[model samples]
Target: MLITQPSDLDPASPGPITIAQPLLDHLAAIRADVLASLASGEPVYGVNTGMGALSKVRLTTDEQKVHQRNLLLGRAVGGPPWLPDDEARAVLIGRLRTFLTGDAGVSVELIQQLVAFINSGHVPAIPAGGAGSAGEIIPLAHAFGPLAADLGPKEGIALLAGIPGATGRAALHAARARRLADRLSEIGAGAIAVIGANRGPYHPLTARGDDVLAAELTRLRNLVGPEPDPRSLQAPVSFRVAGPVIAHVRRTLTHLEAAVERAFTGVTDSPAYLDGEFVGTAGFHGIDLAAHCDHLTAALAHAAEVSTARLHRLLDPAVTGLPAQLAHEPGPQAGLVAVHKRAVATSHALRRLTLPSAIGTAETSNGQEDVQSFSWEAVGGLAEAIRLAREVAACELLAVHQALALSKRPVPPGLQELLLAVANVVPPIEADRPFGEDLTRLLDSVL
Candidate 1:
């Protein structure tokens, strides 16, 4: 990958990174300027002076040389569940973007070592949880410390300065959430067919100039087509509000996408070099990224709750006018009743993760670093939410497939393949055999 700009970094790409000589030369010049500032007997925050609580303490020449190395070794804390290979690559890509602009004043040699590590296709075992530092020092140390035996003046601080741990995972999570969002729309379309819900709410004019709602309405309209003989004049609130709820998810996703883009492209160096002088900056703080992640997680949890409501509707005899629970015989075979229970459980679990991680604050490093973004926790929460959200989708699909089968209504052409796929893994609720295994298969092979 050739990185001419921060936007050039593609975390999803498998790569050996390459930088043009001019950019490398530019970085070298910045390094020289930083070194000159250090040589003039002036204090630079992690160079000739101490860091954090010891910022005012001056260092000897020998201490200055070893400070960079010690910074990484001392900060490598915590243990596994290390980041998976893809997320590790993303962290590396985020780190590389920090280096591209030379604001951190990192050496080109250090930059090359980072490139070499990426090109080698091996990642260090950086811990995926228990990260509570002011920035991402713990994970950053685990990721980069072993690669370089020695680091120049500002290189160590540069490596530890940004919240790449959060940014990298957020980028991946936002993409994953988007896919989940689209799949939920398709699943909602299936439920509409099975429920024979009133078609009024899906009318284009109901959108009221909201593009996201309009798009969802169009999708549902096309998928369910003409519902000539609807079961009710107005469906349950859950069914009526499906379009708006899904449109809300899309909006939250849009907010996350914008935040991730800004993080990837913005400078995030603490004590960044500006106008040929070292200056402290709050660029390391990631409140925007953290809060947006919380928003998306909460939105997904709401979607799951709505999906569970719709699943319950499919089981109600009054709603569907079909056999209760879509069972062949309601007495001996419990049918999809237990499935709705599981949906309820999963939906509640997802709801618990909606608490905002960004609202919490802590003091560390002798109170020199007094507050944190809790960005890692935010992204991690979303990751779990994605898994639970999909499981909820699986539950709703099971009910939709069973209800449509018992209804004897012709399946919509758009939903034929989906119901057919569900039927492949989740055989009809013929005698209420263990549904846990069927749900497992649906999650593994289908959803």
Candidate 2:
């Protein structure tokens, strides 16, 4: 966890430090090689010629230096609503990771400046949208625009050639989603215990050799206590399938982790230095990251749907064998009816956010950059989906806690601990009051 290189920068780490020696040595070697290549007068893309539509246009030695500065200035077209501090840090880390691969043909001085920028904690104001290229040209331009005067040789193309913006955003979302998935398991166990769900569904014999299901069964048994008498012949599908649904979410997260790992270590620049020569490549593409983000979005949407169903069951008298809406006075008080509506609305929004952004593409850059990953749009939508899902989870926890309070059956010790935490912030709903503040407190407590 020392963060000696870009790959060592953890999402949870507090801040950046000075670059270590091993990284400095690799950078020195790469810079020497790039200088050697330039001395040989070999035609290299972005170093001696124009970029994109003007690749065939060669440049004089003096013009090539000017091109470097112009590259950064021309692409600084990012808009408002800047990326937050943590995400901005992630963006720096992503670019630094790619730099460590020694494929961008940048100088040691430029690398040190980047390290200084990160360590000083001064995040550039990178706008929120406008990524239409194979690589994220606009955002990268804004991020590195302040340092444009320092760029040399092919460094300008190097800065814009990687998908760091998309990768950083995805990394932050993945970290948050992973934490939420863990909390989902605990909340699901509490809901199952409160509902008096049949132990039969969670039995080891019924797990079918799936490790995630088997693990969930053990967790539910511990929370609710073993061998509970069923309230009905069978519980609702939402109650019975909570274990499997959470298991699927975990599986999706695993796939996303693999994609993120690849992004961290892989070379994602065009005209990359590989096998001792500068080679043209499509390494800047972000389809793997974008596709996995779409998958995570779908998984979260499904979890929201399941949570809404469970909340509905808790509100209905026939399903829970409790008074309607968990009302203190069955006649006058409205109880959790409004809370149910809020949860339903959040679930609907989650579904809308799940439409895959990677499925569509529009050609830009005069058809030079025809296909795009749209990974930024995909990660942005997924981030919103995750936020809505957290709201849905808060609603379910509130309703389940209230339902458990109304039940006369003796609660297990483990469940009592969970109930104590919920009751600390969300008091038993005896009458109708503004539950918005209560919901916010509950979300903060649980998440």
TM-score of each: 0.93, 0.94
Q: What does candidate 1's lDDT look like per residue over 1-447, in tens digits?
A: 787766777666665788888888999999898888767898788777888999899999989888888888988986888888878877887788777888888888988888888888888888888778677788888988776587878788888887876888888888878888877887898888887888999997999879999998898888878898898999998888889999999999999989988887777887888788888877678889989999999999999999999999888899989899879899888989999999999999999999888676888989998888888778889889989999999999878878888888898988778778888877666787888898899888777
Q: How many pairs in model 2 have backbone atoms within 3 A of each other, for residues 3 or more apart or on separate chains, i.e. clashes?
A: 0
Residue-wise C-alpha lDDT for candidate 2, range 53-134, written one tens digit per residue: 7888889988987888788789888788887887777787678768877888788788888878888888999877777778
Candidate 1 ranges beyond 4 A from true positions: 14-17, 20-22
Looking at model 1, residue 213 earns an lDDT score of 94
Best by TM-score: 2
Clashing pairs in 1: none
Counting clashing residue pairs in each candidate, in order, gives 0, 0
